[model samples]
Target: MAINVELLKKVCEAPGVPGYESKIRNMIIEEVTPLVDDISVDNMGNVIALKKGRSDEKRAMVAAHMDEIGFIVTHIDDKGFVRFTTLGGFDPKTLTAQRVVIHGKEDVIGVMGTKPVHVMTPEEKNKMPKIKDYYIDLGMNKEEVEKLIEVGNPITRERELIEMGNCVNCKSIDNRVSVFILIETLRNLKECPYDVYGVFTVQEEVGIRGANVAAHSINPDFGFGLDTTIAYDLPGASAHEKVTSLGEGTAIKIMDAMTICDYRMVDYMKKIAEENKIKWQPELLTAGGTDTAGIQRMGKSGAISGAVSIPTRHLHQVIEMANKDDIDGSINLLSNCLESLDKYDWSHK
Candidate 1:
């Protein structure tokens, strides 16, 4: 079965930033509960769902993070402007004039404002904008703003998912798209050899906190991190530097900054793709990491780990784009991999 675009849109637009993932976690639990044999949330707020296999010995863990990059209220100025700190990695260039939702006592709408270019000097224009130079304007007086918002409330980009041509664009597609894929795969698994653990992790944007704990607890024989990878296949990018191209296929990571994929697992994925005629590309990311980095080293001796990535453009930005075919292909490949896991000799190097 293919991923439902409407469901994908909802998951991408849900408000969940790192530690503040209760909303998104609850949504996932509702959709995934019936398909899996059991499900529960852990202390770190990671949602762990299970689908029992024919045998109980071999287990496979598939993880996709639910948190997205956002901000937290740091200080409220006398004039009611809110100063904030980023909760995850962000480019200052992408902050100007963006709409945001401050999850205060009540939802507060705000806009990120900066000095107008018309009033700036050439030197000022040449210098890059800094996060410190910007503040969220709620258009309220100091007293009113103070009454409505606290210093610790989370703030997220206020953008809804839109379908453009053959792609889907949204703010939090970085890993929510992966979550959709994992859920769809489990729904499509008619029969499998090993027990499957579908984990929707939290705090991955800040650090791989949820995956670390989940992996250590489950101790699966194999693991896969489902997440998005940068697709630098746009204008102004050199051919060799493009990490992976959009619409090509789902990416199979050879190695990335955080994790070196197990050779046997990589080969296993490739073989399954070829046998099933699913489109795929080999990925080698120069920078950035995913939950795979944390899962590959968790528990006793660890499990052989690898990742299946969707090609995404403008990742971590409001208008992230991904192809429909790539999303469908990833679901097929992951489901096939789960069905054939017990057939492989995982202990072999």
Candidate 2:
């Protein structure tokens, strides 16, 4: 079960910031169409692909968000420097000195700027960063900037996917990596134990908005949020504080700020992983949430839910990294889990 690195790279590099998800959505839909029996894009912009099963069997769902954290142009100064606001969350420190593409009437390449240290007071050198301290320079005059760029144009980091020794690096890997996992799982799936819905949701960076809408319409007996969990296997982090380690395996969610994975479902996933010889690990995220939370609480009554997380490093940054082994392991584990659901007793006993 090798991950198609080429596919993952295309997904990671696509520019989609919250409200502007059409580009990423079309890419997902085009690739997913051949793998599923039926597919549709809901009004909320969720690309839902379905693989049907026995009439009497329970339905299942898997979701991965397609949106990336980025910014939108708020104003263009007289010097062609652009002021922007984040469409989703970002660590202010990572926003400095990076290049971005402003998606407008025509895509414009720009560089993020900040005051040079040569003129900064010693006290200012030690100061923290604020979004206000940054601006984007498009290298054009005020007339050229205003004539071409709109105030609401979306902006995305200029990044290329790189294959490191054991990992892949790029932007949008937070959820795009999970999107890759879902698509690959569907590609390899032979037959489903029950009807399975694979949803590529939108606006997850702003909130789990698309999932909230999709879950209600395609209510399932069980749900799985395919997403990335933090991997803090670097220096200065204690053992327990490291949510997950890269290359160890696919992460089985136990709990996160948004949802505590159903204990029975957690055991079910672990059982399949062991049976299939797929590497697996447990994750406990301290903050942030996933579409799993939305599906778990959708409709009048919730459904059984859990998440399969790819362990990622440098989350919400320009250089998000995911292990190749983890990607392969997740595809295998999730495919097996989906195929085994019909016979597996979801009962509490």
Candidate 3:
């Protein structure tokens, strides 16, 4: 089936900066509600949906975080300029002159401001821009800005998802794209052998906070983290350092900074993909992590864990890109794995 670009765009553009994931949470809840047997939001604002299996003998949790890397309003200066702190990881080079939305009492428009090149000293032009040196300009004076905006407000990039050649580009596609894949997988499942829990987690950008709580409460027998893996197939990156390449296929994690995937789970997914003709690629991210790391060691005896990742380029940037084919492949492989869980043995490894 062809992936829905419009739906993917809507999910990516929806505001959900770390702790403030209500809007994206609600959007996911609506899409997943009909696909699962039951659904509700957990204490940490995770949208948990359950699809009962034929026997309920085993429980499987599939996690896809809804939160995105953004900024929070830290202080507002007298000139209506706002100083902000990052809510998640960011590359300092990507911040200059980017458009952003200051999610205050009402949404306030702003732009990351910097000294114009015309007035910059030669030394300043040679040096890299610092996050500390930047502030947001909302085009309003101190008095007017104070009455409408305040500290602790969330901020997001103001880019819409768009299709270019063979890729889809947008903000928050890091994990929101994964959320879309998981929900679509469940929607296509005819039946499941093990009880399935589709968890759209919150606060992942801050520190995998929501998944920590949801895993403790549900305590599944197995877990699969659906997320985006870096695709470093760009200029100035070495072949060895490139984690995965765009359009290759869905990425299966072997290891990352935060988690080492279960060997058995990885093998199982690879076998299923080969037998079922689903395309896939192996990934080893040297930096960063995903909810899989947290969920793997979260419960009574813990759970066998793995991840299905969409290959992405320019991750954490406003115009992150991914291949449509890889997304469909991920959905297929994930759904097939969930359906065939009864045939696989988990206790041994």
TM-score for candidate 3, please give it.
0.98
| Candidate 1 TM-score versus the reference | 0.98
What are the per-residue Cα lDDT tens digits for candidate 1 across 1-349? 3459999988989999989998999999999999999999999999999999999887889999999999999999999999999988888889899999999888999999989999999999999999888999999999999888999999999989888887889999888899999889988998888899999999999889999999999988889999999999989999898999988999999999899999999999999999999999999998889999878888666889999999999987766899999999999999999999877766676
How would you encode candidate 2's per-residue C-alpha lDDT over 128-149 as one tens digit per residue? 8888899999999999998889
Point out where model 1 deviates above 4 Å.
347-349
- Best-performing candidate as measured by lDDT: 1
- Where model 2 places Cα greater than 4 Å from the true spot, the runs are none
The local lDDT score (0 to 100) that residue 154 gets in candidate 1 is: 97
Evaluated at residue 286, the lDDT of candidate 1 is 80
TM-scores for every predicted model? 0.98, 0.98, 0.98
CA lDDT, every model vs. true structure = 0.92, 0.90, 0.89
Per-residue alpha-carbon lDDT of candidate 3 for residues 1-349, written as tens digits (9 for 90 to 100): 6898888988989999999998898898888887889999988899999999997877999999999999998998878899999989888788888999988778888889888989999999999988898899988999989987889988999999888888888888888899889888888887898899999999988888988888898898899999999999999999998899998998899989999999989999999999999888999988888999778988676889999988999987766889999999999999999999888876673
- In model 2, pairs of residues that clash are none
